[model samples]
Target: MYQYSPFDRQFVQLRAQQFRDQLERWERGELTDEQLLPLRLQNGWYVQRYAPMARIAVPYGEISSEQLRMLAHIAREYDRPDQALLDSAQQTQDVLQASQPGLTLAAPPLKYGYGHFTTRTNVQFNWIPLSKAADVMDLLASVGMHGIQTSGNAIRNITCEALEGIAPDGIVDTRPFAEIMRQWSTLHPEFAFLPRKFKIAFNGSEEDRAATGWYDIGVQAVKNDAGELGFAVKVGGGMGRTPIIGSVVREFLPWNQLLNYTEAVIRAYNLYGRRDNKYKARIKIIVKAEGQQFIDQIEAEYRAIVEQDGAPHTISQAELDRVQASFVVPPLAAANLPSKTDTQSKPYQRWLAQNVRAHQRPELRVVTLSFKRVGWAPGDADADTLDALAQLADTFSAGEARLTHEQNLALPWVHASDLPALYEQAKALGLVQPNIGLLTDMIACPGGDFCALANARAIPIAAALTELYQDIDEVTDLGPIDLHISGCINSCGHHHSGHIGILGVDKDGKEWYQITLGGSDGSALSGAALPGKVVGPSFSAAEVPGVVEAVLTTYRDLRTSQAEHFVDTLRRVGHDPFKAAANGARLDAGHRTRQAAETASA
Candidate 1:
């Protein structure tokens, strides 16, 4: 649980009071909604289709237990107070309500309600009324917390692998680095107002759990010649209107110079990044527009910044040591459980293979709580399930909970012996699905349902595809593959990075989708495929699985059996066959189709 500093606390109260006064003026018919909107939004407030929803930037997915309890407390007060069960929307609203403070606004004029939940390290909430926003800010300040640079053109959040400290295989514990960056970037005067939002991610795992490549600046934990821990810095990657993987600028970087390097990169972006073209606004475009070679030269220009000035790096080594000390690993007993009778049970072995990870210490195991069960939504976790997971973390995993970027939970430090009982409890709560990297563990965003920008619904499409892959055991046996679905051109679901990506489109109000293949998830990427025309939803569902099957079938025959796999075979033969399967014939070559097209047109 992260404790906020007094400065952080006061900042929260100040922002809340500011918004509260703005709300009062709007209600008195003195301000237009458009004029009042941005002012209200500066402090995590937004008016949505149904009601207002607030988004707080949760830098590094680090929230205190007290803060979480406060979130639950706020929700219970909002809707169904007597029932003790607030509906999802209303609950989210209360958590999002901007903290209110000094502003003299009539609290009675505003009826406030809010709720809190994490969606990819961003704290999302259905927000309360604007009038009482100040009081909420006061409460948050008392707890040593505030919401700054959570929105607008600023450093949104510094994210890391959710299992940072818990996972044994991770290269470094990212919490220290995350906290350092968080403090460094919080309201940095010069870099505060940029052309657009900026996000950073850090990961040490080989699995790329932090989605390193999909950030403005992604830092992956790596070791140099000295065998000391540091990060391989990646620059200019992002998602949304334009998608590109952050290219690695440095093969190796020393640990102490992280903040310095980060400042240089941001400063470079601040100076050269586009202000003219909003579509081409991100640092990715700057990297692309300036050319990677030229970008490298520009980075060289800022070597002085890295060596000397910019981002004075407020946090020191001793400070970093103190911060690292704060993240206390859960205390687990030394005894190991008997492997047989425990892991050998029916679902036990499967669960162990899929959900469990070894810890840095020998006696404990890290449990990856998968959200993808057969019937339920992929990332959906009910209150009971959440509470149950919290209890399991306390029981088997040294009383600690880790939230993953994949929108799942991790009960780190679980004893191997206790896995059977823990599995049973989790299965009852619908959290124990023995699939971690399989196709069913797909990343699909809330498309048309919750997001106003969505062109088509992505959730149902992903679920249907999951069902298809489930229906075919052969396809399921094709090893791990990423199937991501985004509802619109923005690619909010990260479809570009998926091995097989689906982007839903609206063609005259009917649902349609386009498929893109070979796009990678990690840093080095396979470029996006040429998407086919808008195929209606009817063909989308039926043809999607069929295309996958056809591709697999071709892979089996053309391959040196299953050992060659899908990606390797695709790399060898190219996308002609897949295009033929998804689209129709006449796609071979001009020599073969030379006469055919003339006759069709004639």
Candidate 2:
């Protein structure tokens, strides 16, 4: 993990104090709600459906145990909704359930005192009181963490591959470059407020684990023919109402000129990106509408920036070395020999095969702690869980953990020999679920329950599916499936990229879900990155589990063999059979609902 320099420490502390002053002013009526809106947003405070939600940035997904502990502290001390507020919220939800006939509302009661790991490698708190926001910020700054640039129509948290420095197949460690970009973009006055939120991702490996194709700007580390390091810059990729894969603006941009080239791209977008309508403000819209003209504009802007601007932002070798030094691997102590009994255990073997991954060093391993278990929302960690994770990191991972883009934590420094001990500890903490890429390891957002923009709740659907697939044998037999759920078209859960995407929708005041098939996040398993195709009309909420079961059953039956994956099987055999299976399940569920209603009446 990158150590915070004195300046970095001072900067965050000062920023926290400034926010406190701003907040105080707002409370005193010196600033109106409209006046405080942008200020609060830049500080990562959002007024959600019922309370303030705070998003804390974890740059490039690198986090230290100390930071994790601070986050835990924040969750424990401040992330609480009043009892009255909770009751009122529950009443509203109950009313909603009553309004929708035949739809089973299994959503758990509202929760707080927890942090949610987001797909962008940030942590979110849903029920933090607005009055204590400053105090939380101060605590975060004490641990070299903050919510800067986490929200607003500006460059959000810069993300990289979770296995950036440790991946066995990594070409170049993109962490140093990503950190440099993060520093440059934070509080950048020139592009503070773009037409819409812009996201950038860095992928250094041969595989796109960072989902670069779904970002506003995707920077893939590449080596030119001459063996010089550079980047393959892709722009205008995003997932929302308009899902478009990024276009390669520059096939090879010199590594030194990364900042310069990036500025040009954003500059071009800022000048022409839509502002009148929020829906079409994303860079993808401009890219889609203009096509070659957008590319030409970026190129022209780049030329001017380099030739006329003297390429002021070019990365210097000394600067690169300074940033790279912080990412040096920690010295490892000699590891204890594994116990024969532990190594022979089937549970240990299953965990090794599922949650543990190969590291660059043969003596090391990257272990993912599963947060997608039964009875909890995906990516959610309570205060106790967060504190325990910190202790685990301190014990086995050189005090560092990486927040993965898949909403999980990765112990990147776990020694190969320490796997058994770490597994035992994590299992005791309920973090050792052997389902890393299985169907139950799904990604979902805090839907209508927390987000005002959502049309329906996502947690109940996720919980139902998780319960349905609790059998590890069944899940493992199903193979690696990317099941993603979102509450709305915003795609916060990255539903557009899931192999089986479940999007919550509203139809005539009732909750419905639309199922899509064959999407990919650009992984080896998921082939080229593309949005999933919708199978049919949205189904009632009660029918979602059956609908999914039908799709998976169809997959199992039609697949060439057990070795065939769901997405591959879907592509091999057209969507007709699976679509029909889903619709049939919906019909069956409706019939069951009608029968139960009639019985009750009788």
Candidate 3:
């Protein structure tokens, strides 16, 4: 984790103070909603259906135990219960349930406040009041965290592989580069606003866990034939009404040129990206429109910028050394295997198999803490849970934890011998789920329940599917599946990259779901794949669980063996079979409805 220097602390405090003044002015009626909208948005504040929502950034998904504790304290202290707020929450939850009949109610047992993790690996508090928003920002700054650039048409959080430093097959630890980008892009005057919001992701690992291809900019750390480290820059990738896989603009860019090249790309987009129509405003749109010409323009601009005396290339060696030193891996316990008596329990074995991974160091391991328990919304943790997890991290993983782009937490350096004890502690906190890569371990967005942009309810749909596959044996039998849901086309849930993608859509005034099959983010053995293709007509939310079940059943029947994952089978069999199966399920449901109606009439 990168420690904040005194200068870094000063910068954050200055931003917080400025926001406080702006908020005060707004409260005093010095600014209208239109005038205040962009200001609040850039600071990650939004006025939602019932209350205001505040997004707190967790940079590269790394947080110290102290920072986690601060978040817990913020959840408990700042968010007090209000009857009106509760009523609004209930109303939203009701709408979610209406779309998905027979779904379990998703209202968690609340105290003062709740925090939900987002696909960007950030946490959002939905009940934040306008007056309290600035206070929350101040609290965050006190702990070297802030929500700046988390929203609006600016470069949002600079994300990278959560397992960057520790993944066994990782080519290079990209966290240092990611942190450098974050510092440079934050409040950059040139890109303070843009045609639309931009996102950037980096991955050094062989497996693309960071969804690099679906970001506005994707940087893959690579080593040249001479063994010198550099980057492969991909641009124009994003998802929304238009989904695209980023094109490789540069096959190999020297590591020293990272910042200058990034600036050049954004500068080109800022000058020519669509501004009149928000719908077609992403850099991906412009990249598509211009094709090779766009890359040519960026290359020209990059060369010109590199010629400047105080260009991005001026970053000092001393600064690089300082930043790298902050991320040095801590010493680990001596190697020791756990005794059979400690690991023989069935539940322990299952959890270890699902949530734990081999570390590069034999004495250590990486453990994923699952947040996908039944009855709770995916990616949600209460204040107490966060507090307890923070304490556990301090004791078990050297006072730090990492949040994955998949919306799960990772204890990156748990000793191999500490497995049983850590599992027990995590289980007590309900963070142990033996389905890390299975059907129930699905990725979902807040959807209609909380998001103003959502057309349908994603949370309840995810909950219903989890309940439908309560049998662990059934989920495991289904094999590894990536099921992702997004409430709308913004693709916050990265649905386009999932094996089975569910997107919520508006059919007239009703909530309906559109299913896409045979899509993946290129994790297949072949290294070639396609984005999900929509099946047939959209189905109602109530029909989603059954439709999903039908699709899974089709996969199971068609797969040659359990080893053939859902995406591979879908590729082999194509979407026709899954579409037919979903259509069949819909027909059966219609027949059942008619039969019941006829019997009642008789």
Candidate 4:
């Protein structure tokens, strides 16, 4: 469903008539909120403490059933999950009911999950205002969509593997090289102002699932040696407050010099990276201060700007067959299998054996739609369950929807007999609770309520430790937990690869936490042990799930049973009894198991 080009309809209708004449000169004050705040942040707007948020740009996490009915028509005409936005880093205090003292707490609707960080493809408008934010950018540029470069420091949103090109175990078809690096990095008039936001990913599986060692520039799609198809790249990956990964500097790279080797690795970090540290200006800290043969001789002088054929629109095999014929896929009429009555046939085959995934077309089905359900709020999801997942993507997807960088939500194709009516409309929009890939399916980030840089309050410490693991049969009876959370160190809540990690800090401001062990993502054993760091503010937020059940009761007393899970019992007991169970001392010995379950079942 990726149509639109005549240069993407004249750069989104001339950037929506130049943001409708800068929204009529910022409503007649002759345009000034710091000169229309970078022209309403290049049309994604923002000014939100309660109003004006506007986001819109869904580039790689595709969409369309007419852009999910224009985002359920802009959150049913200007949002209302109780009109939140007072710097929404997800604060609480609103819950009231005493006979509707003008009811305000979270209404059973308008939850709004489906939002991953900026790698293009957005949808965040929390209560917009400011003269109707350019009539919502002229109704998202009449549906083709806009919200250019998503945020400042340009070139974000080129992510891949939202089951890219229907992954039946992919190796290439990263949605036509993620739409030729999203049309050669949209808004590219000399890489449009860069020094911070860059992110790029491609990973055509062997199961890297596009975390591609956290990105800045990470690819993988291999083949070469005349089997043609190229790229292995991986230059200096990222995540905030220093989280490196990406290293390999091109183990293949042939396919038509993939845009002159990514414009010679972003013009060697746009003429030698680092612009006086705004958080060590990422190009992955200029490829960790230029090593690896000086960034492979600066990508061999940008692959000699693609062997002198010049870089202006280079990766063309007829523009990857006209953007892979607008992502082909669209032919699935011949239904009539509906009859899953046995309590929907064993949780629909155990939630499709943990959220489906086998499409390269064979009657499709890639699905995911998880949002880590423990005790809720892993990634919220409300607003008539996001317009009933936009009308269940027009009856069990193919009308398309995709979004996930672990925040989960993707119906890439679906058809295995409409996976039991999309698992009863995603369990009535509590979004299929299989706890995909496990560890309560986490990946926290919006730490301290509306982060202006957090220090505690990563959503009530990830909702008081998912209500201390609120017994969903003891979280699938403890299996694949990855649980992450961040408030500081800007890892946006990836709290460093979580096998069971959590971090939040600020002793003076009152609140502190840290823990790590056997972290992961993929490509078989990534990494994370960290450990050393833990302070307290009465270790608040209901003592973080009893300090993660005292590091799962010192991983069930150094596992030898319960068939080891918590990252294989924190890799066979290390880190000083999982750092004395996240530093609060064996949570008073598992709270003396509330008097030994009433003295061993009496």
**Residue 585 displacement (Å), model 4:** 4.7
Per-residue lDDT of 352 in model 1: 83
lDDT for residue 60 in candidate 2, whole number 0-100: 94
Better of 1 and 4 by TM-score: 1
Candidate 2 per-residue lDDT over residues 1-602, each given as its tens digit: 78779999999999999999999999999999999999999999999999999999999999988988998898898988999998989998787667656555366777789999999999999889999998999999898899999999999999999999789889899999998998998889877989999999999998989889899999998988889999999998998888899988889988999999899988999899888999999999999999999889988998999899899999999999999998878777644644433777777888899999999999889999999967689999999999999998888888899998789899998888788888878888888889999898899999988899998888888988888888888999999999999999999999999999999888987778899999998888999889999999998778899999999999999988899999889999889999999999989998998899899999
Ranking by lDDT: 2, 3, 4, 1
TM-score of 4: 0.33
- The model with the greater lDDT, 3 or 4, is 3
Superposed Cα deviation of residue 462, candidate 4 (Å): 16
- Per residue, candidate 3 scores C-alpha lDDT tens digits across 287-375 of 99999999999988898897753565545668677788888776655324343445787778888888999887777889999989777
Candidate 3: regions farther than 4 A off: 95-112, 308-314, 331-342, 524-529, 598-602
| Candidate 1 TM-score, true structure as reference | 0.79
Candidates ranked, most accurate by TM-score first: 2, 3, 1, 4
Give the Cα lDDT of each candidate: 0.63, 0.90, 0.83, 0.66
Residue 235's C-alpha lDDT in candidate 2?
A: 92
Among the numbered candidates, top lDDT falls to 2
Q: Using TM-score as the measure, which candidate wins?
A: 2
Over 4 Å off, model 2: 98-105, 334-341
Question: Model 1, stretches more than 4 Å misplaced?
Answer: 1-31, 39-42, 63-119, 126-147, 292-311, 333-343, 374-376, 469-476, 523-565, 584-602
Measured by C-alpha RMSD in angstroms, how accurate is candidate 3? 2.3
Error of 2 at 580 (Å): 0.7
